[model samples]
Target: MRNGNRRGKPVEKARHFWPTTKRLISYLRPWKWGVLLSILMAIVSVALNIVSPKILGQATTDIYDGILKGVQQMKLGLHITKYPIDFNHVGQICLIVVALYILSGLFSFGQQVLMTWISQKVVYNLRQDFKEKMGRLPIKYYDQHSNGDLMSRMVNDMDNISGTLQ
Candidate 1:
């Protein structure tokens, strides 16, 4: 038999999360633009990557078709297309794809930097509020509570929260 009780542990009651989530969102309301811009850039990046495959495929198809046309005209004396392979056009498409991805990466990087700034500002505000609350609390409250526990509540707990956010 196991040393400990067979029943592992008691299940805790589940807490409703939406209200807390809404409160957090309310805190972020001030930097709505930062969050919104991050989301928008993410959308743009996805769009660019999605369109890239099609453009690349077009360039690939052009190369293959041009090769086939050249072979047919030379071997069978058949004219598939009047013009030869359009290297210039394929080169332009490749350049466009590269530019689009670069822009997407830049936007994504900017969004991450902006969001990091906003999150730090919010964290600073929250910690400052906790400090202020500690100052305002009654002397009796501190006298009754363990100093170490209270300090941990203020510092360690907040650090945990900040870590979770990050």
Candidate 2:
């Protein structure tokens, strides 16, 4: 007699998603240093983003003050050293701003690199371990769960956990 199942391949049984999640969480246990590095990088990048604008604004205010004072000093034939408007001083201030911008950009890039490395590593390890576990799992485990359900638990659920880390 021919196989007469309506679904053709076979219907998958229900899987335990929670156990898979717990297993994946365990994979992250050994990567505390990478995780911490990622966090630190992110924090520094955010702080630089907040601080850069303030520094630039200060530079602008200082230049304006220098210019106003320079004008007053020039009218009295006094040395411009005491004045705020000196071109050299403005140049120095501009240099500082440029330095700050470069530093902030570097920090932001570092955060991205560290986070990507840490996240990818953690995700890779979790997937590998999960795959191994699935292989070793008994046929009876599959008896209660559908293939689609298991796949979703491995892919979608793992992604959800990684997203939480981010």
Highest lDDT against the true fold, candidate: 1
Residue lDDT tens for model 1, 1-166: 3444457655545367788668667778999987888889888888888888888888899899888778878788665655478999899989998998898888778767777787777778878877898899999998999978877766765565555544
* Model 2 residue 38 CA deviation in Å: 2.5
| lDDT of the candidates, in the order given | 0.78, 0.74
lDDT of 2 by residue, 54-96 (tens): 7777767877887787887888788765655556766776787
> Which residues of candidate 1, in runs, are more than 4 Å off?
1-14, 74-84, 138-166
- Worst-scoring 10-residue span by lDDT in model 2: 1-10
RMSD of each: 5.8, 9.9
Model 2, CA-based lDDT: 0.74
Residue 41 displacement in candidate 2 (angstroms): 2.4
RMSD (CA, angstroms), candidate 1 = 5.8
C-alpha RMSD in Å of predicted model 2 compared with the true structure:
9.9
